[model samples]
Target chain A: MAARKPVFNQQVLYDTTPLPDSIPKVKELGATSAPLFSASFFIGTRCKDYNDDYMQCKTENPGKGEFECLKEGRRVTRCARSVIKDLNTSCLEQFRAHWECLDDNNHQLWQCRPAEWNLNRCAFEKLGLEKVIPDQPPQSTPVHLRKKMIFAHYPIPSHAKPFITGQEEAKPKAS
Target chain B: MPQDMPPVGGYEAVQYKRNIPARGFRAGYYLAGAGAIMAYGWYHLIVGLRERNELAREKMWGRIHLIPALQAEEDRDLVRRHLADQAREKALLGENIKVYHSDRYVRPTFAATPGSTTK
Candidate 1:
């Protein structure tokens, strides 16, 4: 494996302008891509309604959504930041390990399964965030829970217990 | 002048030997071997491609599963920045003046701003 160079996102565009005094202040998420990807599903679970609402607002507002949907958009940002903050406080070790692994492996999650497994368990136990792939076949095993990853360069079978239980692939019932 | 007749001792027993009948397998056997190897290589190539495609699908879906949340997060940031810009304009100009002629909520851009001329 040709080792990839560590690429941390150092360039952040800072808007010097301030929000109107009327708008409530909320800090933007500081977590970059790898960390965000690591905690993405948790963010989805915790902030799904806010996210969907924001998206719906945008769709409804059409060309005016950017300004018109500011309220919903703020909700999305606050919720995601809170999820990241919770991850930092509760599962910092596993979270760091997973995101660092993701960073190292060009953000291919399968390559960092063991670290991800640790983080997922921590998140589910401590934060109630589950990594559920919506609309995937119910009978099939999830990629995250697989015993083996065929494409991984260094396939280490994770021995960690699943955060969510009873993923035993069920047979199709004869209707 | 004598039609180039052999001169000495019948030219050392005609000085020539046959091609030794190509001491190897016949053309049919060689073709069969080559065909078998090609077939095996093609089979492996197909299998390899299938495996690669499956991996690609897995990778794609993995990202797909996270896109909604990521987009929402990104959209939120843009909204915040634009709102901040609106506030700054109201503070400085006493009201939010329209950048464009018709009102449309454009994603945040400094293109219309004087800052575009600066670094």
Candidate 2:
């Protein structure tokens, strides 16, 4: 990527043109950031081999990987899409709840563990995909499974503010 | 002129200092207090640093795990464009023309131009 070959911007033309007939076609995955993060572990579970193969291809072909590794790339995409589809069909409620919580919490996994637990349970039961933190000690609870998250900031309490409105009028004056 | 005449023995030797009876602990005690506070702070700092490092590892692995799927998404687009360019050239020229000197692949350095920048 660092090897510079300058193509001046003004003279360059846009190619609205799409893939030719010779190359096989694949649909792009539609899951956005939070949803993707939510489903990522399951994708890793099912598509580990395909994902590794695609990465290996890219690694072996540094500059030309983008063009040369299209086959492996399609496989990775397909595998991820399958995982997402299976989750949607089998664990829709848990999946949506988890991703929504993640979206609300800036996508911090620990903040959304309750929802994640539900999702993980459903995924494991239905799809047999598990979420495991690689290289973590087997004896200790994973960070996600911990009861308390040290850094998470819980929602601010309305502590100082009155809980009931118009109660001042309802009650007789103290004086 | 009686004048203030030293105002009755210079105002009774006006006590210039705060007579608060050595307000704080001794110097050694202060050092001990400061050292204790610092030790406490350093302990928490190290714990926080280790937690942060662990979190960093988690975040890095999260990104690493996602890379393949992300790459696949990106690669599909690249493949489509490459094939599209090939098709476009063939349509215009009626044959696959070799731009490179040899048959070896050379990566394109520029991004695909968009149809309109404003949109």
Candidate 3:
């Protein structure tokens, strides 16, 4: 039997920027050609921080201790956890990689490179930074949106869990 | 009209007669509700069986894949014995349902079509 081929469209890689007047950029780091695994495989089934509507993190469960950010003047926590159970191994790896890239990019764009402020400004403007990052980081997005972003870059393997539930009680028992 | 109307006793009789049909309708509604519950139970049973079968299939796949490493080069007899035990266990479980036939006829059955957008 012939193997099933991967499916891709424009929507696969880039998300429509919610901000007005901007082109979508490669927000996700890893790219794949596989389908997402089942939700049953994800770690956290019902994470408290997940915001279903905007697909972003909520402030419910902050990873970091509560602190005010200089850039946004809002109390924030570094915690962002996934809600899916037993996410596919491959997808999980890719997700971590993509996240690392985003973190690195954020450091370089915002904090590290003081000399390239103008270039960073232009890059941020072109990438629609004003729109993507809110004035005061309204709330952190849930992990699902991050997973969707990861899937956009990489072909999600079949049955990739959307989020990893960080809580122990939420984890699925091995049957 | 009071003069022509039936007595109070007759009024009670008329009311009793009117309630008979309503009582019958209530009984019928309860019976239909009971039947619907039974049908839903049967549907769940079928789904559970299918899931069990799929789990079993996965187990068998795992056992077969693990056999090569578990039984090394010099253990041909042990490998044969292990395979036989697995086959015996599978046979003991027997066929839960007609899986192949059901898959073939699934389209015509009540099951939803593939990629069906209907909730």
Candidate 4:
């Protein structure tokens, strides 16, 4: 009889922060190719700051309802989102390389060390989170026509729009 | 006269014999059968060894590749959950989730942003 091979489990390295209950689960989102690893790296790398801000907010708003402390929560979430976006934009190629390497190698971190290192280096240089930053910094949002600017950058569902002015204008005039 | 008298007194002897020769098989038949069995065994041995080698190779490379890939996948899931939480919070705060830009490093001008001016 042939000898049976022993199975070895590899160590899993990743952020362990629990997302708020309000957020949908990752499996439910059904994303196939999202920049998840890179985003986690960015968030995990700066988790301490986010946690500190949240704690401070909670302390300041003692005895207040959770809703009242939402402002602070928003700040932490905004900072994380900003960092995630920055990683996606700036270190996208490196992120893809690392991710692909892991996938090709069946999620082995050691085999993908080179690609992982590259992604980390790129994220560290591009994220620029070394300085203490606000939740939604002024520079993050443009001053003039900021709403329009944001809408122009991202795709907005038609149902989300408060008005349909273009359709109204295009309608034929009554005789 | 005496001989003829004796033949009439005694019964004639009868002989029993086969019509064809009883040769069983040639030596070459046994040799061919042995050769076929040996060839079959040799073929199985070679194939078995090759399969074993391939399996060993897969095991060796698989150990290196699988760990990082799984970690990467898990990390992505974590990020996805984080983003989902952020989105939910934005909605709860009555903020324009779709129209909010949070990257500070991005240039502030309309032209500096990609896909802003062009369709």
On TM-score, the leading prediction is 2
Candidate 1 all-Cα RMSD: 8.2
Q: What is the interface root-mean-square deviation of candidate 3?
A: 26.9
User: What is the CAPRI rating of model 3's predicted complex?
Assistant: incorrect
Model 4 Cα interface RMS deviation (Å): 21.0
TM-score of chain A of each: 0.83, 0.78, 0.19, 0.41
True contacts kept of each: 0.30, 0.53, 0.00, 0.00
Local accuracy by lDDT, each model: 0.71, 0.74, 0.29, 0.44
Error of 2 at B105 (Å): 4.9
Clashing pairs in 1: none
Model 2 scores a C-alpha lDDT of 0.74
Per-residue C-alpha lDDT of model 2 across residues A20-118, encoded as one tens digit per residue: 667787887888988888988888888899989999999898877887898898899889999989999999999999899989988887667667777
lDDT of 3 by residue, B66-85 (tens): 22212121122222233334
Judge candidate 3 at residue B98 and give its lDDT. 43
Model 2 residue pairs with clashes: none
Residue A111 in candidate 4, Cα distance off native in Å: 4.8
Which window of 10 residues has the lowest lDDT sum in candidate 4 chain A?
A142-151
Q: What is the Cα-based lDDT of residue A167 in candidate 2?
A: 41
List model 4 lDDT by residue over A1-175, tens digit each: 2274221112232223355666433322122333443344445446546545555655665543133344445544555555556766888787788677756755444344445545655665566433111233344321111222121223333333211223323553532
